[model samples]
Target: MIKNYIKLALKLMLRKKYYTALTLVGISFTIMIITVFASFVDQIIGANTPERNRSRMLLLDKVSIYRNGKSTDATPSVHFLQHLPKLESAETVSILKRNEFVSFLNGKTAGHVLQQTDENLWNIADFKFVEGKSYTTDDVKSGARVAVINEKTKEHFFNNEDAEGKSITIYGQAFKVIGVLKSAAAFSKLYGDVYVPYTTDMNLHTTEKAIEGTYSAIILSKSEDARKVRTELRSQMRKIGRNANGADSLKLYPFSSIEQFAKSSSSNDDEPEYGKTTIILLIVMVLFMLIPAISLINLNLSRIGERAEEIGVRKSFGATSGALVKQFIIENVIITLIGGLIGLGMSIYASKLLIQVINSFDPLFKMPTDTFIVSWPVFAFCLFSCLIFGLVSGAYPAWKMSRMNVIYALKGGNSL
Candidate 1:
């Protein structure tokens, strides 16, 4: 019985080759677009997880003071590092200070400030060492003039040569290369190439003022409970920096929290509604699939009308409604499944073409390598979507074919 249904299904599909082709094409295009969108969203969310030791909590000044008729925001201040005792309980605390207009080897200029940090800075950020090692406690204590460069910096300056133990001039002073970092995503603010000891300025530059020149301090909690640590740190900061009314209004944020805040703040006020965008895309895809499905359903109904005598004859010969429905459903399933397989193949080819187009762009603008590569999830998702579409689209047509009245259908007076 199943074999007969499949045979009939194949004959019907072959008879309407143009319709089958159009349905498969529509499904393929929709699946391809969905796959690409999923990959892009996955890549964007995954960007925040590049470093293994990303902090759960970050310490920043919360107080905003007005001085000289100008309001000063102190939420992300460096002074919190010096006075906050809550940081001592933290798993690790790393101070980051930037020095802009710093010169490097061969008169290469940097528009951004060079970051200075202690040995703990590397541990706090999970900086992947490609060559050599991170700065040690001894190096920080001795105020050694050693630097670590990121992969981009290595490519920019040393070319193919090993950067380790090489000397690079920074701010008219020579510093030895201790390490090179692997290329990292740009989610973190520490995307700069050069890394120097936090103590490099002890002898060269000195300032007693707390807020004179400091970038920010990052504190990593031993446990995942960063909010608790942040609160404690804020309370300690309030004690250290007393306001006129002696109130503490400092804010502390976990690393992930800040990212959400940044994204929300960065969204354009006039952007289209997310629900509208999603609904529009869904409606379009459904319409693309719906037109073909409806046409196929009508085609199947017409084919049934022509074959009404056959169905009526079978019913009179004692075929049950259940058996008839099963036969018709199986036939439609076979036809739709064939179309689905074709669509799946087309989707794979289209996805490959899309990835190639993306990779042709410069690395800076291109999608991440992981995202560009099609994984098992992509194949599974495509297969499932195709199966659902095929079954649902064919169900209505099969049902209508199964519901014929034997007497009327046998009379065969243009019944549909």
Candidate 2:
């Protein structure tokens, strides 16, 4: 029975080739756009590579002080790090300070992200090593000037030469390149072209205030432990706020890997409304899908109207309304499924194109990956969306066909 429905659906599709092509293009194009956009979003927020442990990570990246109705914001302080309460839930913790370093090598000038971080940053945020190894805890404690350079930096400075044991000159300071890493995603907390011990940079470790300075902290733990960890960190931060001399109101901002990016674009600097941001994103995607589905419905209505005579003939031959509806829905689903496959292929190609276009702009924008990998879950969700798309657009037209007067339908009219 299903085979017959598919055979008829294919025959009808070929009968009106241009309309079939138009419908497929509409569905395919919408799927391609949404898939590619979602893929990039997953790359940024979802656990991809070095950020694989993101689901279990918490970051206290910012702090704010309210003074006399004015707001002063800064990175979480070294002082806060120095006095952090024991995070019993944490698997690993890191103290990180970010700055830019300029390098002039082989008459080429480039700026690189210089992350002054403790060795624990290596533990909390996974960095895939191309060669050599990350600086050890002993290296950080002794203020070793060893550096870990990313693959892009390796390309820029060495030009395909082996980087380990080589010396890289950054900001007129010579640091030995002890490790080379695959470039992490640009938006990740671990994002940097060069990583070195914070102990090596006196400016980063020097505490300017008890609650405000240029540093941040990340804690990684079991997924179930995140809430407990955040609660403990907040309590500790509040204690510091109460104990500090001449302290106004001190507030710590805690965020997950995804929430950090979501909240970053808020107009308010004090506290972010990320729930609204999430809702807005969901609505935008829904609207995009809805427009294409609406077009499909209108197109289906026109095509079904042309099949009024067929519907009347089938009804005359004792076809039940339920069976007719089922057949039409099956036909729509088949077309949508075909369009989904085309969309899947197009999305993969478009993702690679997008990556190339982004990297074409500048060296500083270079990320690790060349291919945009659409995760299985993402594609699966899209597949389910296609099924829903098929049923919804098919239903109304099929119902309308079932309601038509048998005599009018025989005369090729839609009168009910």
Instruction: Give the TM-score of each candidate.
Output: 0.57, 0.87
What TM-score does structure 2 among the candidates reach? 0.87
Clash count, one per candidate: 4, 0
Which one is best on lDDT? 2
Worst 10 residues of 2 by lDDT: 363-372
Candidate 2 lDDT, 198-302, residue by residue in tens: 888867546655567778888786564456776676676677664553555667666676666676767664345678778877887788688999999999888
Model 2 score (lDDT) = 0.80
Mind giving the per-residue lDDT tens digits that candidate 1 earns over 1-416?
78887887678667877855665565556556555554444333332433344535453323454444554555433443544464555787777775543444466543333678767777767567889988898998798999988776676568748999998777778889989877544334554467888778643344333333354666777776555665666566556554522323433433433333333444432122345545655676566556666666676666777677878887899988777777777766665566556655665566556755765764333322322433456556656665666666657755665577888778874354
Candidate with the greatest TM-score versus the true structure: 2
RMSD of 1: 7.7
Error of 2 at 337 (Å): 2.3
